[model samples]
Target: MGSDVDFVAYVCEQAGLGGALSYRKMFGEYALYLDERVVALVCDNMLFVKPTTAGRALLDTVEEAPPYPGAKPHWRMDDVLDDGERLGRLLVATAAALPRPKPKGPKVARPGAPRKR
Candidate 1:
């Protein structure tokens, strides 16, 4: 089943990270980003945070699972959702550990479009 938008919004609101937190819907799921770095995935109403050294260290009970089929296991964060402070901390650490996203290439002109003189 697809994840509900309310669930995704609740998750972001619970993070309490303010403007830095955002989510994008993909297919039937959602990807949560912190400061432009992808920090977690919400699928089937389950939250899967990207595993990182700092993030793992903060977890009291470590759990791992894939957000979707054929994907690598992430740190399943069902236990941490209610704790906004811990969730914020983990997200910051994960975002810090992750490399910045690669720059997107410039758009190419479509064929048959009029060229500039």
Candidate 2:
């Protein structure tokens, strides 16, 4: 079953990272971002945080599971949802440990559009 919007909203609310926290719907699920870095995924009403040494160390207990089929295991964080402070800290640490996303190249001009002078 697809993830519910309410669940996604609850997860976001519980994370409590302010403006830096955002989520995008993907394939009927949700991807959680911290400072523009994808730190977790919410699928089937479950939260799957990307595995990082810092995140692992911060968690009270670790459980690994894939957010979707054919994906690498992540730190299943559903149990931590209730504690907003810990969740926020874990997300920040995960984002910090993850590398920055690559910069996108300029978009290609449309075939019918005029080229830059």
**Top of the candidates by TM-score:** 1
Q: All candidates' TM-scores? A: 0.90, 0.89
lDDT of 1 by residue, 75-116 (tens): 888989999999989999999999999999998989999998
29-71: candidate 2 lDDT, tens digit per residue:
9999987799999999999999999998897788898889999
Q: Candidate 2 clashing pairs?
A: none
Candidate RMSDs in order? 2.3, 2.6
lDDT of 2: 0.91
lDDT of 1 at 58: 86
Q: How close is candidate 1 to the true structure, as a TM-score?
A: 0.90
Best lDDT goes to which candidate?
1
Cα error, residue 6 of model 1, in Å, equals 0.5
